[model samples]
Target chain A: MSMRALTGLKPIPPSEITPREVFLDRRRFLAGATAAAAGLGTAAPALAEEMAMKLPAARNAAFSTTDAPTAKKIITGYNNFYEFGMGKSDPAASASKMSVRPWTIEIGGAVEKPRTIGIEEVMRLPLEERVYRFRCVEAWSMVAPWIGVEFNKLAALVGPTSKAKYVRFTSVVQPSVMSGVRAEVIDFPYVEGLRIDEAMHPLTILAVGLYGETLPNQNGAPVRVIVPWKYGFKSAKSIVRIDFVEDQPRSTWMKLQPSEYGFYSNVNPAVDHPRWSQARERRLPDFFASTPTLPFNGYADQVASLYAGMDLKKFF
Target chain B: MRSARAADGRFAWATSDPVRALKPLVFLLCLAPALLLVHDVLYDPEALGANPAETIEHVTGDRSMQFLLGTLAITPLRRITGWGKLIRFRRMLGLFAFFYGVLHLAAYIAFDHYFDVPAILADIVKRPFVTVGFAALVLMTPLAVTSTAGWIRRLGAQNWSRLHKAVYAIAVLGVLHYWWLVKRDLTWPMIYGAILAVLLGWRVWNETLGRQRRRPARVRARAEPGPAE
Candidate 1:
C-alpha cells in the first residue's frame, strides 16, 4: 500500500466520537484487512503454518481475524512513546529485550476484593479492543490497537465506595526488571492516577495483550491501564498495583516537578509545556508530517464531562 | 627583548634544549579530552541512540562547558597553591575550551537548526535556556580572539586581564543554561552549579585579599620615588 493510503486516516474530531462509533469503526477496518490478507494467494496458505498461531480472543481487534503483516506492523511500530524509554525509538529495541513471562499483579488498597492475580487471570477479563491515538507531552503520538477489558469491571470487583476519589496505578519497580529505573533519571515506581469517574469510563481499559498475542513486556505486558483521554504518560506501564484512594494520589512526574507536570495532564494545546510547544505532535508511521495535537488526545466525547467547569489550561 | 633574543640565537649553538620542544608536546597533551570526546562520538551507542543529530550536539556542548569551567578554575587554583607551572598549561587549556565551544555552537547551527536563522533568532529571544547559552557563546568569542601572544601584547596586560574576566560571566551563564534545560532531574546541573560557585568564589577572594595585600608595597615604593616617569 502507498504511504498516502496509510496517512489517509484523517484526524478524528476532538469532541465528537463515541465508544460505539469507535467500536464499529475498528470492526470494519479489521474485517476489510482480513479479506485483503486472504487474497494474498498461495503465500497465505504456505505462511500460515510457519507463522506462530495467535489466540483469537487475545488478538487486538485491529489485527485480530487478519493475517496481514501490515496490521501487525502498525500495532507494534505505533505505540506509546514511554515504552521506548521516553524517546521515540527506545521502546522498539529496549522493549523487545524485556521478558514478560510468569508474571503476577498485586491488586490492593481500597478494594474489598484485594488479591494477587496471575497474569493469565488478568488476561481473561471480558474483552473489548479499540484503536487509540496516544499523544505524549513530548509532542509525539501513535495509533495502536489496544486489546483489553473495561476498567470499571475491574474497579467494580474492587468495590469502590463514595469515599474513593481516585485510582492510582503503579508499575513494577524492580531496577533490574525496568532498566530505566536504574539511572535515577526519574524517581521510580512510575505512577499515574485517574479521578474515580475517569477510571470507570467504558473507554478506559486494563490491557493484557495486543496484536493477537500476550503483551510484550515493553508494552506493559500482562496488564497496564489505558486512559485514552489523558496524555500517553498517564497510561501507567508494567503495572504492579491499583490503589483506590479517597484523594488524588501523587504521580511520579508531579512529585518530581509539580509545575511542569500538572495532575490533570490532559492533552490541551493552549497549555504549552515550559520547555516545548503542545500545539502539534509528530505522528509515528507518518514521522515526516506533524499534525495539530487535539485536546483530550481526541477523546473529548468520552471524557470532557469529567472535567466539566474546570479550565484545562489552569489544570494543565 | 631584542638583545635577549639576539643573545639566545648566538647561544643556540651552545645547547639544544629539549625542554622547549616539550612545551608543544604538553600543548598536545591538553587536547586529550576533546580527542576522547570525538572518539566517543564514533563508538558510544547511547550518545546517538535517540536523535543521533541532536544527541551529538548535546554531547559536544556538555564537553565544551565542562572544559570552559576547568580552564576558568586554573588561575585561582594556581595562585592559591605555589604551582607556577600551571601557568604554562593555562593558554593551551583555554584554547581547547574555545575550540570545543566553537564546535558546540556550530553543531547547534548546522544540525539542530539546519542553518534556519529565523528559528535560531527566535529561540534566542524566546527561550531562557537558549538565551543564556547563546550569550555565553557570544562572550567567549572575544576571549578566544585575544588569546594569542600578539593580541595580549597589543592590548597590554592590564586591558587583557580585564577583558578576559568575561570568562567568569560565561561560567555563570553556562551553569544557568544547564539548570534551565533539565525537565525533572536537578541533580546533575546542581552539581555543576555548586562547583562553579566555589571556583568563582575563590577568584573573588583572591582579588580582594591577594591583590590588596601586595598593593601597599607598590604604593609605598612609588611614593618614595624621586622622579615621575
Candidate 2:
C-alpha cells in the first residue's frame, strides 16, 4: 500500500465521492481517470467464442473524443495490419485464420518483478471506453472508442527499476497464419518503443476491444497498444512482450526506414513523409475532402510536454 | 477444295467478319473498368472501401497499366497467332491506356493534392515515384494523338513505328512508378516488373534472332522488317 502511494500510482477517491467500484478496485488508475467493476475469469478466443461475452467498460467521456466515431463496419473492414496482408481490407478478410486464444504477454527486463500476464489477468484491471482520434502515418484518421486499462496501471504491477529509460513493445508473429509473416514483407515480431515518460503517460492504454465488444481478429484481438497522440504504428498490435529497457529500442518501421519513421512518431502535420504531405489527412468515407491535421493529433494539451525542448523535426 | 477450305479457315478470323464482331466486345471490355469505377463513385461507393480516393487512384492507375500492357501485347500476340488484322486494334488499346492514365492523373490532382498546383508540381518534381508516373503519362500523350490514320499518313508508317516504340519506355516507367511507391510488399510490383521484363526481353530476342523463327513466309513478307514495327 505504501509502495503504491510512493510510486504515485495509488487510486484516489473519485471526485471526493468514491464510486463503489473506485474504492473496491485496487487497480484503479491514479487521477481517477476511469472507474469500472473490472471482471476476471472471462476466458479467451474471442473468435472461437463468437464474442458473446461482453467485457462491459464504462464510457469514460473524460478521455473520449467529442467527434463522431467511425462506423464499426468500416473500422473492422478497413485496416493496415500488414501482418495479415498489405491491402487495406486484407487484415479483416484473413485475420480469422489466426486464433487469439491462450495469449500471454511476457513482462520483463529492467523490472523488479518480472512475470507472464495472461489476457484474462490483464483485463482484470478496470476497463474504460476512450474515444480517441487515431491518426495513421499513412495520413488517415479515425475516432474509435477503445476499451482498455491505462498502461501505467498495468506497469504499476512491477515498478520499473531506476535503470529503465525506455519501453519496447513486440507484437506476436504468427507465421502460420499471417501472410506478411510468411512472405517476410519487412520483418516479423513487429517491434515499437516509447520513452519511459511517454509509456507512463495517462493517454497510453493497452486496448483489448472497441465499440462495446471484444476486438475482432482484424483489430488485434486479445490486446494492443493505443497511443492516441502518436502515429498508429507507434501503438503496437497483438503485443506479445513488454520490456522495460535501458536503451531505446529500434521499431520495425524505424529499422525499415529510419528517415521516415522515428522513435517518437507523434502526429505532427509540420513534419511530412517525403513522399506526401502530412499537413492534411483524408478522413474515411470522405474521399476527395481533407481536414487540416492538428499537432500531436489534437492531444497537444495532454502530450506536448513529453517532447518539450526537443526538436520534433529531428525526432520525427 | 478441302485444302483451300482449311487455308480460308486459318485466315478468315483475321479479316473483316470476326475482327468486326470482336471489336465492340473488346471495346466494351476496355470501357467496363472505367464505367464501374465511375458508377462506384456515383452510386455504390461502399464497394470502393474506406479509402475510396486511394481506391480510385489504384483502380485507375492499375487499369492504365493493364491497358498499356495490353497494347504492347497486340504485336507479340499478332505475330504468334498469325493474325494480320490484330494490329488494327492497337490504336484503340493505346488510346484507352492514355484515357485511364488521364483519369489516374486527375485522381491524384483532385483527390490527393486537392488541385493545389504548387503542391502537386512540387510532389511531381520531388518524389521519384510521382516523377516517373507523370513522365509515363506525358510520354503517352503523343502516341495517343498520332494514333489516327490521318496522322499515320502524315508521319509515314516507318516514322510512326519508331515514334510508337516509346510505348516500351512508358511501360518501364509505369512499372517503376509502382515499384518505388509501395511501403513494404513488392509482390504486385515485382509481378508487373516480371511481365514487363518478359515483353522487353522478347523484343530484344526478336530483334536479335527473329528472322530464322517460324513465321509462315507469307506473313513474314507482309509484316516487313523492324522498320515497320
> How much lDDT does each candidate structure score?
0.68, 0.84
Off by over 4 Å in 1: A1-116, A126-135, A139-150, A156-165, A173-190, A201-203, A209-222, A280-294, A298-309, B1-47, B76-92, B95-99, B102-127, B208-229
Write the residue-wise lDDT of candidate 1 on A21-139 in tens digits.
23433554465457568885434322322322243454345422222222355445344434235444455546643444445777677777778766655655677656677677766
Which candidate's lDDT is highest? 2
User: Model 2, range B84-139, lDDT digits (tens) per residue?
Assistant: 88987888888999999999999998887888899888889989999999999999
What DockQ number belongs to candidate 2?
0.50
DockQ, computed on Cα atoms, for candidate 1 = 0.08
Each prediction's TM-score against the native?
Answer: 0.64, 0.85
Candidate with the greatest DockQ versus the true structure: 2
Model 2 per-residue lDDT tens digits across residues A1-316: 5877789875665455543332333332321222222332232233233532466799888788899999887888889899998988999877866666667999999999999987877777788999999898988888898999999998999889998899999998888989888888877789999999999988999998788877777888879999999999999889889999999999999899998889888899998887778888877877764678999999999989888899999989
Clashing pairs in 2: none
Mark the regions of model 2 whose C-alpha exceeds 4 Å error after superposition.
A1-49, B1-16, B212-229
lDDT of 1 by residue, B1-229 (tens): 1231224575432445443445557667666655765775678744344334445556667777777877877776666554666766677667777777788878766654556677568768877988998899889889989988899999999999999989889888988988998764566689888889898877676577757665564466456857664
True contacts kept of each: 0.05, 0.63
